[model samples]
Target chain A: MNNSSDPKKYKNSFLNWIEFRLPIVSYIEREYKDYPMPKNCNYFWSFGAMATILLVVLIVTGIFLAMNYTPHTDLAFNSVERIMRDVNYGWLLRYLHSNGAAFFFIVVYIHIMRGMYYGSYKYPRELNWILGVFIFLLMMATAFLGYTLPWGQMSYWGATVITNLFSAIPVIGEGLKTWILGDYTVGNATLNRFFALHYVLPFVIFGVVALHVAAVHVHGSNNPSGIDIKSKNDTVNFFPYMIIKDTLAICVFGFIIAAVVFFGPNLMAEVDNYIPANPMVTPSHIVANWYLAPFYAILRAVPDKLGGVALMFASILILFFLPWLDRVKIRSCNYRPIFKWFMMLFFVNFFVLGYVGMKPAEGIYLLVARMGLIYYFVFLLLITPFIGRIEKTKKLPLSISNILNNNHSEQNKFQKEVN
Target chain B: MRFIFTILFCFTFCFSIFAASETKNAPKHEWSFTGLNGTFDKSAIQRGYKVYREVCAGCHSMNLLYYRDLIDIGFTNDEIKAIASEYTVIDGPNDEGEMFERPAKSFDRFVSPYLNEQEARYSNNGSYPPDLSVITKAKINGPDYIYNLLLGYVDPPEDFELGDGMYYNKWKEGEQIAMAQPLDEGYVDYDDGTENSLEQLAEDVTTFLVWSAEPELEERKSLGIKVLLFFVVAGLFVFIAKNRLWKSVN
Candidate 1:
């Protein structure tokens, strides 16, 4: 066939590329043009997009950092310093990577809270919530492993202590611990393994995040009203509006992250980490990173090792069962006064526990920790279930539309009287 | 939602306990070096430089430090320059007038054995002489343990038999140590007129190693305080903004 006579083939190839090779801007526009976002979605909805942006920032900075980092126990710490001192703008890279981690966790926690407030985990969205939890777990694992790669004193000891937790199991606990450590202690073998895992786990997290988004896309976002979008009038398409909103949010979030990196690079890091790993000497206060501090506090609240481990694990696992735990027919917490109060209290208790976790585990601190711990569990297992039931029986609108209509009528009556 | 909360609460509770216990028992670990005042003996650091130059530098590297850092540890600039110049050469371009990598700079990282990976491994019995820049921090026991371990090497215990290809050191907590205590009395001729004792040398080198590990210790602490101040200011601003934003709605 003469090439000059093959205009149809050229046109066909161009169409194929358009169909298969996803163009970034066009794809974003088409996908989000009429995105069925709720009109009443507030600041809370920004958190998921915020988390997604933070993840990308973290991944980009982390990949750059990895290029210069030496993961061996011997050179890891020095390599990090070399990056700070020698590599061009390496300090900036490190700060962004690290602070990005903190920001990521912060956004994720808020995102999860938003889900809770909106009952986003209920009904067909349960799997979406579950996948989100899976993403959270993977994020935690990846962060833990990545933290060990710097090979700081904290990194080594933190890895050692956490790995040793596996020994809490009854029978083959020691073996399991050894297997995890890959040696008698957290040393070269441990660092190497952590390096390998740290590199691999992020991809696993990426996969899970894909699943999480897919689930979200499938079920669609839960609205502030928690009402189903059954008709065209109730729903919007996925394009333009939401895409622009998300883009703006990402830009704002990125600006904040950049500010953190530029001005206060190691603001969130501990001082002791500047020191290399010393196997014989330990840092006086061996604290986990700030992101894990809350859970760490929870772990410390329990007196027993096995119990603490179980509770620590349960803290994360609890999110998976949120859909069943909430008994209210109503999805949003907006109308549930008692439930609203409990949620606020729970948030305060969690923060308090984080504070206690960082303190010296003394007499009063332990007691407070225990109490906080108790309230934390009660909020979920007892308060939520009980409050939801009580609220359901109390004076309530039959539907979200009914509640809106009543509010509208009340507003009209007030306006009429004023006129 | 209730189950989720319950599990979260339980886990948080457990995490708090673990953290608490860790703090409570933190002092017991040999590796725990929390309150280590970076206040090292200057003479020790000087002595460490000697040991490093004589023994450790031959195979183990500490490419992170400069000759200038030795001044803070006690050497004069003249002494540091003289010492560094012996190891490095400075060259510059005629047109650009920019200094290029001719030899080690005063602040250049310690030199490694110029061997390729295979050569370095083969010569060292598959053990690479790890960089000493953060060796003190990398080990759990900190500088004291590193000092001790360097001096601890001895023949295997009488009762314990030795495995082929394994070197045994009874003084070490572990029976096997990759390094033979490289430092020995009169191993190197010291130009500084310091007494040449193996223990003294080991102490010096360990101190120097610690310094290399955290060269910006003083700066980091000061910067940390400044950052804290900035954080407080930022927090205050955010708090005010939040109050203003929510006032009408509330």
Candidate 2:
């Protein structure tokens, strides 16, 4: 009905005819090419685009891999080896899918951190954050299932250990575990279901990712300064400017992933995964893939099995409450110095917990993990809720354009003084 | 103040806990295929294959590998055919619908020493031999572990006792292994006239095993370099395009 984006505005007859019916041409132009974005968003903002690209890479590679993969526990390991050895460029596809999982998490984690730092989770964008959390959860489930498809010792035992975590429940625990595995133990039924779910969950993640982008587009992008875009002058069209920047970022990310896939393909893979699944011979060390390490640390930190499982679930669920938790007058950590320091400590603690998780849970590692687990909860529950009340805050520029202008003028003044 | 003190306490607690650990670390081996310029030593791999054929093949299986795969490290087609024919593999039979044995082809995978798990376990004193197809990947520090496991056999230290079928190998955790020392000095003669010492045999076999696990290592590395170069060039162009587009705005 709107004449502003009228199909007739375009001289091309075919596009106009198609646009008249579907309006997809105008829809893309408005939503993507002409979408207004804060001009001051930095490289960190590019990670969202990077993550989306990685998701696409994962899906494309995963599909090709599935074509060659056999889901049966007996043949799964051999099939993967066949892919690596015999199938044409199957090695590349397999490496991309596996390493893509890691890279996806890397970019997503950075993107989440970026959001938190700039208060992208605040106010109207809370739904966007919630959708992101959902996507992340789906991704985790998909990755766990994908890992089981290899039918290696780690895959079998990892499934056994994780699914058995359900048995920590009070009454129906054993029933639930059996129900999930489709058998008493992690065997053929478990692998088959996992394979089925693994194939399906990515589409769910894709749907959630679509909702996430839509929600982000509705709210517009949060910039580095966390100042709202006050005028058209404060923003740029998303087409050339943001697209090019995202392209550059994606290229750099692709380079890193390519290096890992080709040169150091096994850099992130556990060596034990190369062996076929032997239910009789339990590996001395059964560690989850690296991305799940921090939560795995939390799970292991508690002595009781149920308590550990509860805490691990709660750890992720707590993120849903983050928007309300760190309630402050100011949005960005750029203005909240104390909160910024705490955030840095929180990130460092996460990394430490991840490291400790990978190490065999013995004396020192356990102690460190326990301490880190405590700090993680403390930061989420206690510190975040209280820090805003006591923290000293810096003055923020009134708008996005004002901040950039101020910085530019200041730089000019410094240059002039030097001259 | 309480937070700082808690952190300090945790640090000390961790330090004290770790200090008590005394797990012996595996000694690193300086191997040919280690760094960026690394490539498999072809002669060593050939010798290692001989070692595998002569000694290790009796127990350990390499079911993933075909006789033709040896051509990558340099084996003549005739040699491969001869190797394949030496082992008779069980196959299905003619119009009678029964099973029979026949000589293998170049593409047939290595035959297992035992027909199945029960047979394997029974023959090896109830301990099944692990497959060597991806042994160099299945274990941690795989090449090093294999090398050390081969040469690690020694007289049991004072106060240490071994059970039947177990040999003392310092390289393995618990300092014991099931398989007795299979190699001695001048164990298998190398056609290339290399020394057949235990260490030499171990090193050569480890190299071969690494290749067996990952035959495309060379292709992967070379392709990685080219892809990286492509990305760099593309990235530079994107960077320029981005800067140029943003020049007027920023």
Candidate 3:
């Protein structure tokens, strides 16, 4: 794959010199340009590229925001206001970063769901899925910290509430919470530390993302047919085909983000966030942002603080065990009718959890949240492991091309008949 | 088609669920700064500033705003200077090493009525009047909520026991609030010959507060439309390109 001997191989003299020295050109060629992706990958496979684009957008916008942002408790609120009002296009940058975080989650969540639905987490791809889970955790942490940088009512209270979750543990729980906050209460120290960590964590995510992509490249991609590649015909190069599909996906994703930033800028933001931090007054509702709402519902489901916190952490940590939990040979839900229904039900349950999260923890919401919590655990823990044993899977195609070619010929015949 | 229907169903369901979950029942109002084509009514903002000066300024402080911000609402620099001069604010120690008070300047933030939160609370029972700079954005449907509250001084139900120093507002959370009704018919004389009724005063000030809460609203919306137009035009070409690229494979 290395073409260092020939100056004519590269696009120009500068690239040729650089390629001779570093071989980065050949590295990219080996990994991306010449990388073999399953030909049958649908639009779902584009989520990873979309998520990566959003990450870059977030980091770029975040840098501009940090330039204008003052992270101190007293100055943070007004600093943000100044950015919005005085700085040229500060509102746009701030809105993009803030809304970018939300959309990043949307894309990443779909990425995870795609992995799950197609068994991308199974067998050789286990490390890839595990690394992705870690990235998700880091993203949640980064987002929660970023939310606190505004230093508004939600920022202050969310900091207080989430940090206090550590105090639910026995013995050192109180001390651990204090250590995390750098104070007995959520104050200047907490804000300073959060601002620092929020800035630092994204680069950490970038490093882990490198590993995740490496892992993916190592084993290649899992296709819809859930069959491993048998020969060159089962795969296509990443250069023109997959890259073009990703470009279109990125364009569509960018359109969505622009629509939000320009039209309903505060659609994902909290109303109370407009108010500066007032520690004396607690807002009536201290809900997390929509991205974290389902987990927040999990946290509030059990009445006991310790129990709720345990269940919440476990809900996320359970993902690490997912590969082993669903030990079935078959991967794609498309071939598993029962598993497809389960996946659909799981999504519906997630929506229910999100709905119940924003509401006050009383009356019917409590009961519904509890039920959602039970189902979330049962599906991931019980049903996933057991369903494959009893359920009859539809016959899988012989190769990735088998089903697609048949479908194409059938469509052509139908067209001819209509003509 | 099923996919499109599912997406629409999800959006509608999510909005309705979230909307119903919000307990606040603030009546909706048509605002000059709402909708796709909406822009700030400059005259209404000016009138609202007048109402704020005469009524709301006694308790609330717009600590985030400078007198210079008035220029956006059609106030001349000379007029803002005149308005700013009427208020006095504290400045730091000079070479003589002493703090001193001086007439406000164009760059100075609107002066607070009290020195600190404790003083602000002491002057108005124990509840400090919150700053009005972001009042509209701080509450759900901020402008509408404020407008409805200003117009929301309905009598309490017979069974309701009113808290001391609290006035009943039909729209305010818990049906009670600390600040008394601050506006009435002919509360202020409008310089532009606009009628000075209670409703008129509320509307003007609500418009002003909305501007303060989101000064970039007009710019954001207009830029959004341009971006959306670009998306449509550029999207068509990209869509065609995508189709052409994938045609051979299918």
Candidate 4:
């Protein structure tokens, strides 16, 4: 064995450890050192940090839930109830787990929109954008699977409908469906598999998230100007500056989550989920968890199952091509005249579709959903590319500093006029 | 100012009307199973427990419940301890220095198969055993649904044909149930010398399962009342705080 306190050897080991750890923190600080962030990057930027905190909260709460959760079909629903009623602080645990999911989606949506408004998907940062899309997809899958573990009517029937969608394939439709089900239908077999996948997928998402942050670190965050941050003078360190802002945002978000948990624990959950699953009867409305409602609406908007599934997928996948499809040189809608209005209309259209999705798919609601679905596709595929090229844009300030300088000049002129 | 006030008044009136109408028009489905009403039946729960132990326990597991839970569910201590002793053992810091794994203790719950993911799935034709603790709540239909499903399975009509690998049962409308109802008359010889009928066994097990699902239903309902009281107090405090804080500003 080596001597316990050889100075040279000790020095070498210390150096090795530092060499491994130093680059990560220093690299983050070094790369972001002069990277100009928007002075106007308000509470929106906090969503990303809030999303990060929510993810951590979810993983921790999920672990505790897993400890008490019985994954068997006969026992899974009962185990959840047991957690709520029997286990020590089981109610709090269940409340935290369920509400944490809602908060996670809320923060993530805001985070993604923050990226959208600021053109965070533009060149060099495209990988980060794609990773985010991937994360969103994984999150959706995880949530869907997690929801099914309860084997409630919604969980069972929802899985049945979703897994059966694989049967839409032309040749191997039935076979594929059977393969996915691992049985004749969405029974114990399906529930068991979903449980396994639900547990496994989150860790996979965590891996992808690691890559996402790494990519974001590599390219750096895109500000509202969409200009290269390296070219500007006003910049701050990620640790103290961004960290502090993120912490404050997290506190506010925590307040919101606490309020939901304390006052209205089941506000976001459906009442039907309180019951056990029976395949013989279906619920009146088979809606997914709230995070998935937007896409579910798009799916229902189409008349054909295959077509609806395709459209629903395209709705999300369309976001992946945004960096390239958007031809406009400018990033933010704040400066884009015509594009700004279109973006607002598109947001409202999507919300309308969400509303229509929750309603029975018939009569006026169907018509509304169809119309909203058309706009949903048009906004992404046609309008995004078309507007990017055709819209006449105003000349943007060379940098954030230039915008500030112009504002100062304009203020001085107003004072002179007043005098 | 009058026009603005009138518009606000109209909007509030319309909103309230809409809300009231929506609530009234909300769909009400048949919620009761077996058309039975009142508090849960303890006898039914006891029967359900029997059905679970004899039938479902062979394949499915409820690893969350301890032997002691039976006592809470209306079983005698002697009966529970007897059942527990048959299944598990206790060994710790006794006169003997050696560690021993013996029959389960009265406090011990059912143990799941100690199979890992790969092993569990492989043994069950690519399906893992799910824990039963929360299955009732996880499903969309409540206990009635589970009960209906359990009793739904029957032999298919003579003209009906099931596809390959599909098992036909008359109880299910689709003519297939993954699980064959394990409860049959006289399947288990009751320890307490009670005559065990299939229907009686099924009802008992279902009740037991429901109890296991929500052991603290009574506690939760009472706690809900307490929480509502707290909210009432908090609301009043908030009202006072708002008045005090905004008094000078107004």
Candidate 5:
């Protein structure tokens, strides 16, 4: 308050004084305030900002939930009931934190799809994409661990099945499984440790997200055309341009989320989760949550236990190597006619695997899951690398500005004629 | 590429509608406490509470509710006080370090039927009845499940051998259940002069259970309406602002 700096130009004097010392304002201004963004980037680009906002929502709601939650085997289930019944707005907080996990994954998945579709993982942006995959891996762990904190039937059995996956390891697997559970089964010790871990993993994710953003800023964002930004005409300031678009996306996204949170809070939830965890009686059907279901499907695609576990872990780990996997010169699928179809097929196959994961590992569903699994591996490991070499490439756009002008010229002949 | 996704979304939606019909012989019953605009019928809830108190309370326990929560189902303060006084709860150790029984208060939890799961199992022939606190939330189409279950008891088919304690329930997964028929005609004499048939009892009890499980349902839906309305208005301005911001770009 007593800073000697002139207050005439500064609306917030303390912030200006702090900025003189730390220079954070200038740093942010350099990195983002006037950051150049591709003018042609579409609604797909909005998801990255949306993911960041949802992460904050999850963290805020999660902290409140953790305050009311009990992490003991004897009291966990009843404590959750108490929270729903007694605590003020505890139901709202619980539902938001629970459903926010799904929403977060939805945004992140779309963000990744955008990355994949435009080959944003290529060239100088490879590290940014790898950092993103790490964040995803951390998110899955956090979500799984948080689910166990409720101590419901689905939470207990899901933890039991997933932990047992480690037992399929060659020799040290059995020891690792016991070490993870702190007992022979998912019990008090497992729940307590999971509570501790879930509380901490989000901070780790936040740190990684910081690095991911830094890496993206190093080379600026990849554009829709997948071409380099050549001059000022090719891009616009991110502040008023991208920020306004993101505000609108957030409103629309928040509206959809409110609809779910308010009206159909339990639509995607497992019914068995409402029951207290009972080791004596197993539920008729056991399944993972929707976000993790595709990998769960890949796990069940194999007959052997060890093989399934290996494939499941391999499926996620393979994304780290995606930068080198698809060696295509053209980035955007819009310009790559043949490769475009394969990419779309892969995207739909992901949803198929998710559905298959929910069904009983029966005849038809099992067959589809296996086929999807095989196609998944074949696309990344086999087709993507070789197709770039054989497929005929389309003519490349000279520049981002040139591409948009061509589109505009076709749409608005009067404006171009007047100009 | 976009076309494929559109088809995938439609296919998944149709599959979801198909999957919702897999309740297996249990028809979806209309309830006063279901759907977007649904609210608990106060009279039905009053009758349902009577059925729960007289019949189901003997086997299962609603351990989550307080005596005071009865106010939501149309009980007055005087009636709640009178109802609570009929039961005794183990309160605390007195000066002598011995726990003593006292008349339950409006704030006290509903008295459970059994002292513990062990007692519940032993008395019920090694099969413990589950808690009814969130039983409606614990099963798919829970009101329908409970209502149909009360009506599901039947004779076994040819060549089917019933276990010593098990009863035949066609709606059950294995067609064998440890729980016998828990409801009968005119089980509880309703004070409201309503019908006391078995089906009426089942429907009323199911309605009360839905309210018990989701006491916040009405508030949630009403708030949802206001929140979504505000969002729609906010969305319009946001869309306009977004369009103006992007007008300079392609």
Candidate 6:
């Protein structure tokens, strides 16, 4: 069935033979090596590669930890202790897994933020963005389930608080909560089901991630200039150039994670989590891990329980509509002036919400959190849609190559003048 | 609509500020093992073990630790065996199929004070004594909190009211606790000629609890230093390689 116009008519014989049978090797070469990418894509683009590497690190380390972990309530804590003290390199494996989770979230957040800043969610790339949002939601579910496997006080109580939120529903809510727990409380059954789901969800994330990459390849990458590629001069092969840069970024990221794992593994960990789970004794202050803190703040800001749950969920669901929400033709914030300021404000509001979530739900912290919550929704729903139509964007570059090779010095001078 | 929402949000916060008045901030205390290079003081850990045996052991159980684990804290094999034999543990069924009590072996965990949770709560007037195996690592500012709690007890201010079985302490939540003043000056006699005072006992016991909570702390810190060094070197090489690879690009 090989056509006369086929590019691979006289290719490597081994690859041609494989392609004639399965086409798997040809598929990899087409998708990964021959894939044209914007040469102007910055280091921010590297975080996606970093996140994928961390996902693999987490899965490998998680499996080893599961081999040593016991799901029973009575033995779970002791089993973890045994893993720390008795098992060979067990402590190292556990630390790497835990710290790897934290680093994974960090890289994923950067990756998501990069997409937003470059307006990668717009137009033809919308499906890719939607798939990414799904991957993120799955990551959240996996993280929540994995956190409970340790059976620490935070694990137990965090599970209880999150599951009990489902009971805020009128009729099916209570049933759903019980079904989730498999009992009236977060106990041995809850831990078992969570462990089972935690193990399964990562593979599901891996599947969705495959779709995400495929979508990225289908639409091509959005770059800093927000200009489409015109010819071969404006693009680069995905093999040696981008691949080498991605490896360098991953190495540096890995070094930072290793330092944290080895020296102060518990720095980000809550001390209260070291305590064994005691259902009767609730911790005086209950908060989620840092990754979940922003949404946790959103959940707590609303006065009513059901309203809070709805809003907390809506915070994530809102991301799905982002492609339509910001109806601008240009992708990158570098061109959209007013949108750029709001984006920075959005970033600040998120961190502020996180800080407030860590505080007791009272006094000045509560007030600040409430204000931050309002701004978050307003920015996403009202501002993002309308601002694009009114904002006067900068003049577009003809192509990435034009900007890079010709206007490089002139662009720097213009930016300096604008500042 | 957005304006109205912002107004309602602001009004809600005006009321919330009054509700957020009190916060319980745990006080920080200086310890020998606070930083990257910090190591647990061996003698302090041994003294802390003595305090635990004398006072805390009556209520709290360190179920994760075995008698043999004490060897790292300077206890000899014979001493650990002697210590283990002090408690009676239910061993096994004999030829007649009867279970009998026998002295604990060195490998056995510290014998729990009560048989089960129901019994433990009943003896403590409904407030269960938590497991102390990881107590120092489990609580926020656990080392400082434990040390302060030991010395924080005082007569309640005349107007202050306490519930039945509750005692006054400066650092406890609500300024009251179920546990009475546990440590006193010269409570546990130190055979090493160290003076036994409330502060000394508190310090020693805190150190011991930290060790129990993280016995691998010393090894972890040393290994961490080595691993970090290796990463730094390897990272430099990778950086150079990546630079060379990209040299051909515009």
User: Each prediction's TM-score against the native?
Assistant: 0.64, 0.94, 0.96, 0.64, 0.94, 0.89
| Winner by TM-score | 3
Error of 2 at A300 (Å): 1.4
Between the candidate structures 3 and 4, which one is better when assessed by TM-score? 3
Docking class of 1: incorrect
- Candidate 5 interface RMS: 2.4
Worst 10 residues of 5 chain B by lDDT: B1-10
- In Å, residue A29's CA in model 3 sits off its true spot by 2.4
User: For candidate 3, lDDT tens digit of each residue in A284-311?
Assistant: 8899988898999999999999999999
User: Which runs in model 3 stand beyond 4 Å of their true positions?
Assistant: A1-8, A416-419, B1-14
Candidate number with the higher lDDT (2 or 6): 2
> Which interface RMSD values do the candidates have, in the order shown?
9.2, 5.0, 1.7, 10.6, 2.4, 6.2
Ranking by DockQ: 3, 5, 2, 6, 4, 1
List, residue by residue over B13-35, the lDDT tens digit for candidate 1.
Answer: 54454344421111232221123
Off by over 4 Å in 4: A1-17, A20-25, A28-36, A230-232, A405-419, B1-22, B25-250
Worst 10 residues of 4 chain B by lDDT: B29-38
Better of 2 and 6 by DockQ: 2
Model 3's interface RMSD: 1.7
CAPRI accuracy category, model 3: medium
lDDT of each residue in B60-171, candidate 5, tens digit only: 9888999999998889999999999998899778999999999999999999999999999999989989899899888887788888888888788989988889999887
Q: Give the TM-score of candidate 5.
A: 0.94
Per DockQ, the best of the predicted structures is 3
Per model, kept true contacts as a fraction are 0.05, 0.78, 0.69, 0.09, 0.70, 0.62
Candidate 4 lDDT by residue in tens digits, A1-419: 45443333224676545545454444544655444355535557767666766777778878888899988878987788677766787887778788888778866876776687667787888888999999999999889888898777788888888888888878899899999888988878888888889888888988888888778777567676666654434345564455555555554455556655654465567656765787777887787675677788888878899999888888899888888887777887877888888776786676567666666788998899898988878877788888866788877777765665677799999999999
Interface RMSD of 6: 6.2
Top lDDT: which candidate number? 3
lDDT of 2 by residue, A262-332 (tens): 87677678777998999989988889787888889999999999999999999999999898997785778
Q: Candidate 1, residue A204: CA error in Å?
A: 1.1
Residue range A196-219, candidate 6, lDDT tens digits: 999989999999998899888886
